[model samples]
Target: MSSKTYAGIPQEYAKLETSKIVLIPVPYDGTSTWQKGADKGPEAFLNASENMETYDIETATEVYQQGVFLADAVTENSSPEAMVEAVHKTTKHFIKKNKFVTLFGGEHSISIGSIRAFNECFDNLTVLHIDAHADLRKSYQGSACNHACAVYEASQTTNLIQVGIRSMDVKETTVLDPEKTYFAHELATNEFWIDSAIDQMTDNVFITFDLDAFDPSILPSTGTPEPGGLFWYETLDFLKKVFTEKNVVGFDIVELCPNKIEKSSDFLAAKLYYKMLSYKFMGENVEDDYDNTYESKAQKNNVTKFNDDEY
Candidate 1:
């Protein structure tokens, strides 16, 4: 959020009209229960991105060449409901322009708005939620917009598949679909988890990734750190497969509580964002047209809900 352009990219590629991607920064952290520094996540992540190498060794590509437009930060913090509405409207504004939208968050709660926008724009949308906590509560702390209820609406509307979850209250079990929810303990032993998760997803997928999904050993700067979480390569392996197999409409990464002393977490978040973009545009030429394939009329149609037995 501090840099003029994302990662200090050239002005030519950062223009909104020509850019294929739009990055929105929401620096609100009013609902996090434990850690308080997630509001600083976007600034820290941007600073780290400015210092990172643009060329991706694994993909043999410079994704920044595809053009990244850094939109103004959404600073609506007067109330949680008002903030979510602001994010929903701003995110939808970019999607309507046919740009690939991505967001950096203050906490998991921001996903409630981002996911809502994507679900309304795309047909049969799948929300692939990767996090350490279930976050399935319909309401928490007298607020439905709290971080704990981040994906509750997605659960009802989209083909919501949760992964890397290791901690949650017993009450969430009533809402979580066991067949689609991959717990961390089970993932460690399930050899086919990556493929299985992808198989359950619809053609259009929206990824809502919480930084706490990574193990505290590798990414300790998050609001809530849990044991038995994911590692770097394995996480990338799953994401690459998703980008390769499904139409990943857009994505959001959240819950980065940066520590003044530990800088690795910020760099990890930056690299993660770049890597996902690389996977998305690896095969496309920068000169070629980029269409996000969002349907404006789909906003009026209700996506048919499915029962567990339907799958």
Candidate 2:
């Protein structure tokens, strides 16, 4: 299938209707240690998105109908501190218009700037971090604002809840609050308390997802792959619950390194973006959009099969 571009002007900004959501693509990856091409992630995801049917199967809504705008990619190269200032200025412009921000990242470090912007508009914000590593180090490779310390910088802004974490160094362990950190092993083995973990979140949430939070089996294109992380449905179920229980104001999806050999990773990331949009905005009305297509037929057939199996 051919790649899809957003339905607006190229590179500057594209708006649909009143523009409740804006996608800011940050294609800068100077500090990545292992993988080098994550700077190309935004374009790859956008290209893959062209083939995605706008309708969501689970939510049953065309979330794109909510009006998504794509902002130009931030391509500046400077110190992490300077980059944060640039992101802050740009994000503050959007926040002034009351638009919800969805940041597409070059690496996890990009979130530091975005979250800094968020703290200005929100007071009781809590971060929901989905990552393979704890990322709680105070500094890494001589930079305090390194990608490895993204979560650490975020915690300075607000309370944090980290999930799907499977790796951490001894230094990270010392700084992190044991109560707020949930390891992937705990989530996989103890399914009964996922709700309890999510319940600890504040009413206003900022979700930051590192692609490595997913099992390397499904998403192997990240810079640092970790095994035994979340599966698709498991992570989605948790997100659904979080959306239902809390008010998610903004979010970021980071660390996607598009590999030509396995294009599924890019497509999956694109689909996940739409799914989150559907859940956040359409809610129960998600299934209402299915009045006109094969999707409705498929959903009905699945429902019928499920009912028949119950007997």
Candidate 3:
């Protein structure tokens, strides 16, 4: 990572020993088929975060005090599969430290690794995949690690709940469960979609948020900009409810393709990240211990198994 501290916080809160949170930046954009600037996302996000106000008004908390250790950027780009493996190992390493591990990504494919690590550590994992596309292809372009197949493993292993879906391939429908998917059109009219989506989640949840899930009018810098997507307040409302009701083990935000002329998207990504952290650690003391509440290895024996052959 280019920045010394996450959001330029003092060294006290940026140290790994005292920090309650770990932020992993995976700046590999090898698999994005559209816009190619997602590799620059982590640096742009860090730069924008440096200028953001640490205080959050809604929660009335400075979540940065919880300490954010910005780990080295995952630069393993030999192949899409290699990058995913590197991300999986790094995320698992932090989760084992009992830290609230979060990731900012180069593309949606990075979620495959982070989600895998979380699913292994948490029992009865529910993957909340918020994206414009279904992204359920078992494999794309001869590689399962392609961005297009980001959540195929989760669909088979975890209780996957999809939201804000407006674009998808017909083949993805075979893997998608309509009962658990909140399509953009349905969400537009459904007054209780938030509650409904939350109700279907298991106790342990891992969120994978794609930037394109937001409408192009609000966030147009994603690799794939989709129309008729989510807005800010409503997205925050849904996220707050999830953090409040579920054991949100970890999360990752992906698909940010920054533009030099338009910097709002970068700031939005930074604020969105801080907002999620605020919700997670709201009302908690920095001195207090943060237990990610992951299942012990023995306890995870009964959890949904991840099969490499399937992927």
TM-score of 2: 0.86
Error of 2 at 101 (Å): 0.6
Clashing residue pairs in all predictions, respectively, total 0, 2, 0
Which residue pairs show backbone clashes in model 2? 4-50, 59-286
lDDT of candidate 3 over 117-170, digit per residue (tens) = 988877889999999999999999999999999999999999999999999999
Every candidate's CA RMSD: 5.2, 11.4, 3.6
lDDT of 2 by residue, 147-256 (tens): 88888877777889999888999878777887888888887677665787777887778899999999989888888899998899988899988887887878989899
The residue-level lDDT of candidate 3 at 298 comes to 26
If scored against the real structure, what TM-score would every candidate get? Answer: 0.93, 0.86, 0.93
Q: What ranking emerges by lDDT with the best candidate at the front?
A: 1, 3, 2
What's the residue-level lDDT of 86 in candidate 1?
91
Model 3: lDDT equals: 0.90
- C-alpha lDDT of residue 84 in model 1: 95
Can you write out model 1's per-residue Cα lDDT over 1-311, one digit (the tens) per residue? Answer: 34499999999889888888999999989999997989999999999999999999999999999999999999999988989989998998887777889999999899999999888778889999999999999999999999999999999999999999999999999999999999999988899999999999988899999999999999999999998899999999999999999989899999999899999999999999999999999989887855544443233333333232422
